[model samples]
Target: MNKEALIALGLTLEQADKVIEGYGTTIPKSRFDEVNTSKKQLETDLASRDKQLEELKKVDAAGLQTKITELQQENAEAKTNYENDLKASQLSSAIKLALVGKVHDSDIATSLIDTALIELDTEGKVTKGLDEQLKTLQESKPFLFVPEKKEQKFKGWDPAGSNLDKDLPQDIGFNFAKEANSKGAPAEKALNPWGQ
Candidate 1:
């Protein structure tokens, strides 16, 4: 029976006992304390996890900064090495041109000669010296260092026209045709049996 019902009915111990005995049921105790304890433990665990995450973030940031410094050092060294190699190659080309009588200005060639002399020294500043030599060359012979032009080859199918068969050595044309045929190429129109 409910507490209000018991109060309203002015139930005696004997009457309550009779009702409960008939129902064969018992009242359960509250679990408020167990629930409160579990809540507190969960909050504590969350706070500890947040603190650990912050420490990990700091460690990661430090590692990233170290990596950046290392990469910057490597890049600087690589640039220095590349500049030195480029100066050496330019000096070599200049010397080759001078020896081949391709130089126009004696003074500019002399500057290259001096730079080459400096490069041969034990503590030579080849990079700086080469720059000075190039500047001198540019001022003295503005157009003498023009790039060499390449000759274009003839690409027509019949370089000698109707006399192509006769002009080309028999062995050369036959070998070329054989190679082309082996690679599944069609025979030249003039050489084909159908004359296509």
Candidate 2:
């Protein structure tokens, strides 16, 4: 059934496989074996070259650690900048909202806010120039000036008369037990009925 067995019987092997199956007939045995061995050698050589290339491209531990540290530092700086920018944006937006109907356009509002924030401190407190700009804006556009909100002061809870003591029995009394401390002071203790 195979070509090699037929060749051993002193008969030449004829075409037995179809060309559509990607196999060629009438190939010499020696040639096929040589091609197969050469193909395997080429594959092995390619794998070896690929491994060497990978070794060349691979980073050392020190280089990789340096890159990681650099990326971490960059990320930290970016985070800090983003936080600062976000805070500035919020401040600018608050000012713009205060100047809603006064400015002719948004650009004017932005410019006014920027001018007011020129001397803003690191804590975002407007320490200088903000009040003057606000006053100027207020005088020019009185409707846009919003008065500062007055802080509401709250009084804490007070135990007031609820007629609680008025309706209680007049003969009622608190009988607390007392103990002698190391300092010889009469220290009050709870009136424990179980003698605990």
Q: Candidate 1 residues 1-196, lDDT tens each?
A: 4544654688886777677678744443446677778999999999999999998877877778999999999999999999989887666554554435444554455544565444533333233355466566667765755445689898878643345566544454555675666565554433432222
lDDT of 1: 0.61
lDDT of each: 0.61, 0.61
Q: Write one digit per residue (lDDT tens) for candidate 2, span 81-189.
A: 9998887786676555545655556555467554534555676544566566767766876654445568998676634433346654222122122221223544453
Q: Report the number of the highest-lDDT candidate.
A: 1
Model 1: residue 130 alpha-carbon error in angstroms: 12
Which ten contiguous residues of candidate 2 have the minimum total lDDT? 172-181
Best by TM-score: 2
Off by over 4 Å in 2: 1-50, 53-59, 103-196
Error of 2 at 174 (Å): 87
Candidate 1 residue pairs in backbone clash: none
